[model samples]
Target: MTMSRRAFVKTSAAASLSVIAASAKAAAYPTRPITLIVPYGAGGPTDTIGRIIAEGLREALNGTIVVENVAGASGTIGVTKFYRSPNDGYTLCLGNWPTFVLNGAIFKAPYDVTKDFEPIGRVVTDPQIIISRPDLPANNLKELIAWFKSNGDKATQATGGTGSTSHVAGILFQHKTDTQFAFVPYRQGVGAAMVDLIAGRVDTMFSVAANAIPHLKSGAVKAYAVTAKERLGIMPDIPTVDEAGLPGFYTANWHALFAPKGTPKPILEALNAALVTALANPDIRKRMEDVGQTLPPKEQQTPQALTQLLKDDIATWWPVVKEAGIKNE
Candidate 1:
């Protein structure tokens, strides 16, 4: 069928207009401030990393990125908020292992870990350090274990609530050493827990190296060992769990960025590119490294890498957490 000249012109103009609208939408993304949700309280390791990344993102995008701390339920509460947010790429969450991978195994969280978010990229990974109050009288892991055995449940372990990394670390410590400690739950996050530990209200904790470093250096807490296969460069004086006589014990915490699922691909790519640029900055790298964060190699800083890590961690840790019968309180 042959179209009339007026009808053909109208159809061509409509098609051209559609293409321009799509291009305009892409070019005008992030027209307003973006919110990056942090699933823990302020001053915690996740919060620290989130702030750093948010600053870098602000610089990269030449736009505002604000970090909002929504702490509770071992980070599930905040993550649930992120899940429910609009998938317009204006909202994101800086999530780590416990919130993104382990919470679903231990609690009936409202969102599914694998299905609820779009991975942006991973930021950093840090090992946990076994730290205790200065007056604990256990200078090393062996002494600490023996002390726990002698004291029974008299010694208290501070945790950032149920299903948190600290909580799981405490459980694993008990299982490995065949000992127990009275657990004290702190809903706010490690900052609150660390405060109590420093004040001698709690006897011990397994904390992220970056979180524990200041206390360790200030003589408020004593570091026994790191929860990695090898010693961290930032704290070479500290021994590994294996070296500290816990032969097979290892744990590491990592942080990554994610947006609500169904965010447009162009926005995801833009966010990721900004993240990669920020991570590669020398000042950023040095600051993160000084705080015991081991940035992933350039090859492993992509969205695919973060997605695979979430999958692998879920497969590896869910069974163990289930068998241990851990649950939210």
Candidate 2:
């Protein structure tokens, strides 16, 4: 069909206006206060990281970045809320390993971890550091496995309730070693569990690096291995899982930024740029590092890196969670 000259001009003008409007929208992104939703309660690692990112974003974006803690249901409640929120860049979901990946397996989450959101950038990562009571009769990973195999039923692995990184990783540990240790859930928090471990009441723990760092430094708990490819900087003496007789058993509780799936690419780029800026700040880096957290390498700080991290975790964890019948508390 041949278009009339007048009709052609009108169509071209409309298309140009649409393009200009979209660009303006992207450029004026975060025109209002941007809400960064932390899917956990205050004072937790995830919440702390969320606030750090929010502070950095508040400065980097040069706009108001308000942090809202939507804590509950192992972080599923807040994430579900975010999954249903507007796709506009103003509402960002700050998620980590459990809220974004593990919870989806334990609970019937409404959103898909690998599909329901657009990535901004991965902020920080804390390796899973396996620990035991100082006198557990297992000084290293190899002996620990041997001990667990013989004393599986009597052994207890303390965790911060079910479906947490510690609990899920504990399940993975059991499966990997063919051990049958029982899980001890702490309603108060893992800090309580750590105390028990320090007192030699609990047998072992699959702890985050931050929680285990001070204890490791003080010789309060026996350090087995860090479940990551590389050794942790703060506790450089701890060996990686690959080097600790349990090869290829890597896991981390990581933080990253996300918006609802349909956000524009320009907006995602803007968000990622701000995140990169925050990660590069010496003070911000020190704060995270002080907590035993490591910033993602500059090369892996992009939205694509974040997307890969999500898909990779989902692939690595969902099956283990299902096979182990890990359930939410």
Candidate 3:
């Protein structure tokens, strides 16, 4: 028997509704524990932040949350694990700048960032500081630029890795000022970089204010300028790169939240809500500030905003990557 056009259409609509109902039912979500994939070694900044966020999420969602560190290949190995996980609310990933953006662009990856994961919201945005050994003759950004131009690539700068955010910040500094320096890639953490900076082994370095602040206070290192649109409230005396002669020089290290692609809409919304609530807690805000980070506004902290930011970063860094002659390490 042949079905009439109206009957056929009605049947198709019913089938679609049934599928939606089934999906919504399946999306009741998190009957079990959730795993937060932290793509870094234990005790690292990413892992620390991931655990904090996981705790907050667990309290809010009323389910156990675990932060799993799957470190290797500069975080790609862990990130790959997250991207390939089941696209349920049970699996999320902790991601930060350069690792989430520049790393994927510069290194071979098993999963495509845009296609394999769903962005939830940004966790924090930390400003990077251009610091020098306390004994350096250059006192600030202008003096440092002049010194580099005069010295001509004789100065050295240290970073955790070649394509890290710290390294990119240094690259942007040279690109803006039209100078060059010997880029020293350190296998160790910022602690080693701090040691070298103190001993004057490196002439300059780009690192987060959190890592540099203690030393800045101890007289071991001097901060030249911060790569932020404005001076940090904690260090208002310090000028931004914009105020220091490069009018538009700005960069920041940022962390973001993500779920494997195909996670339910309700789950994503719930995660975003929990993130916003967490950011409002006075304790969380203070802790983030202590680490040189600030919470972005709620309106600009969503998945859509992250997508645009990622796209803009791709545009912003592609030229810098090419101009700096950077390659995978």
TM-score of each: 0.93, 0.83, 0.83
Off by over 4 Å in 3: 1-29, 42-45, 149-154, 187-192, 195-201, 218-220
lDDT of 3 by residue, 1-329 (tens): 99999999999999989779756754565679888888766754566567777777777677789888887656677788887899878888888887778776677788876567888999888788889888989977888889998887488888767677778778777777899888887654455667888898988888776677667777888888888888988778889888887777777878899988887777788888888777777777777776677789888778899988888887777677876777786
- The best candidate by lDDT is 1
State each model's CA lDDT, in order.
0.90, 0.84, 0.79
Report how far off residue 303 is in candidate 1 (Å).
Answer: 1.2
lDDT tens digits, residue span 137-254, model 2? 8888999999989997798899866798888888878778888898887754466678888998889998887678777888888898999999887778999999999999987888
The TM-score leader among the candidates is: 1
| Model 2 residue 287 distance off true place after TM-score fit, in angstroms | 2.5
TM-score of 2: 0.83
Candidate 2 stretches with Cα past 4 Å from truth are: 1-12, 133-139, 142-154, 186-203, 218-222, 242-245, 327-329
lDDT of 1 by residue, 283-302 (tens): 88887888899999988989
Which ranking of candidates, highest lDDT first? 1, 2, 3
Candidate 2, residue 201: Cα displacement in angstroms equals: 6.9
